[model samples]
Target: MNESELIARYFAPLAGPAGLGLIDDAACLIPPPGCDLVLTADALVAGRHFFAEDPPDAIAAKTLGVNLSDLAAKGAEPLGYLLSLALPPDWTERFLDEFSRGLGEAAAAAGVALLGGDTVATSGPLTLSITALGAVPHGAMIRRSGARAGDLIYVTGTIGDAALGLSLRRREIAGGALPAWAKTLDAAELIDRYLRPRPRLALTPALRACARAAMDVSDGLIGDVRALMRASGVAAQLDLARLPLSAPARAALAADPALLESVVTGGDDYEIVCAVAPERAALFEQLADAAGVAVTRIGAAAAQESVLGPDGAARRFARDRFSHV
Candidate 1:
């Protein structure tokens, strides 16, 4: 059997309800009355999602966080998850302790459980896969296909920080010293965003109320937002002047103006990118403010296929999509 086929036959039985026969891209779970089931999955591989030498606990936390983030986009309260792990022999002790600690901590924070999964030895690089299950009220789940022309586009949290952190990591790999800005910042948080990104679960209710369309920024903002537009059969016009660049990122941009494009196209932000009707824009602002999460209206949906800049100039977005392959 192929890799996924093997998972379906051997692991599906062990996965219980969340497996859904391992048939669809995601399992369809039925929730209680007045509720909807939300399903999302994320997989991480060494040298791709993370480096082999990175801390195991951090990697574990990030794997879970990305999955949780998926549920967050649908306004789902996490229920539980299944894990599939591939480990090499040398990584046993440290990997176990750190990975378990990270996973346990994220599960507790997200109010989820580590229900069941499989562990196997592999000659390939370490890999971790997590499938998170959650529940939202019926008709309350947000979707990427609900946007319309003239809807205002919004995003949560700061962008570009995680990409910056990755650049710093690359510098470290090249035997260069950490830059000054990197030295003063919280390496753990930066690395955590790189490793563990908290899914914005808290923003779901607010999103459902005010968002016409929504998605998490796993791919770069430009690319993911474009996907949302495509899914909804629309286009977009972005105000490049309003992108919420973090202070450090601003500093980095000061050094190199070209970084602006990187900030726009780089991925792993994990923040929510949403669309709101013009009338609901104020409500969204209030909700985001009350929740203490930064939200910015950076663009608007159009009935065309391309995104425009503030000056009415056509700006190119990332052509590449994030892929497991």
Candidate 2:
């Protein structure tokens, strides 16, 4: 299908009322009284952010899901989103069908609707760009710069599932080396975690209620925490053993301790990292628990950024970022 025809057929039905039925060049948004708007955008390219052979539905979910994660980190409720999809010439109808289906499902689940955006044919790889909008109370949006010394740091969900899943996706591990967590080491579940990130939107109420500072862990945990510390003009004291690991991840680490570094420094964990004041840490965890979200205290904000190893010595990571990926 051509650009206009494709958009009208596949995307128009997903537009929100503010989207002007996808007939206008611009979308309208009016924030609620005493509320601040949150905006986040993410771009995904085939063969870079995702495998070219990945299902169109998964690509659509991840493209929008990552953006929602940013909003979640800021303690905002998703409002609406704009999508710009670029399709290669060889794209098929089946691809568009499933991609749009995924987009609609994810948007509805996140309480967001489609706003207006562009669609075009690209000679390059399949690319998706989404600009998501969210809402929060005035002066209530959590920021990376709000952390202070003596605050406790918490990370939502487990870490490194996505990173380990990527390894399985690349066929990096041998068949005989499955983890004890599962007969197949729950390989499909790991891969699904990589493809479909669980944005902690439900945890936002707790974050807004108690978090002093917050940011989503997109890059490696160590690098993202360091970035948050730098933004807050404070330091962090982290315990390596405190890092929460899923059962499969724990089993994998037991089999090969070397994977620990990769777990700490690989990308796409997509969990929220937040700093809560000492007095509020208990309430934060309580709220998170009520929301059915698992949060673990891994460290505290300090005068200097330090990570302690299991041997009770300060250890340094070879790289702060996802350079390994």
Q: Which candidate achieves the best lDDT against the true structure?
A: 2
lDDT of 2: 0.88
Which portions of model 1 miss their true places by more than 4 Å? 1-31, 178-189, 305-314, 317-321
lDDT digits (tens) for residues 1-325 of candidate 1: 4546545544454344654655556554445778877888888899998888777777877888888888888778888788888877566555676667767677778776665666777889998888787888888888899999999999898887787777787776678987766665554455556666867888877887898788899878888888999999998778777788777776776666666666777788899999899999998899888877789988899987555543567777545345557
lDDT of each: 0.77, 0.88
State every prediction's TM-score relative to the real structure. 0.85, 0.94
After TM-score superposition, the amount by which residue 104's alpha carbon in candidate 2 deviates from its true location, in angstroms, is 1.0
Q: Kindly list the per-residue Cα lDDT of model 2 for residues 203-247, writing each as its tens digit.
A: 999999999999999888999999998899998899988899988
Angstrom error at residue 227, model 1: 0.2
Off by over 4 Å in 2: 172-184, 323-325
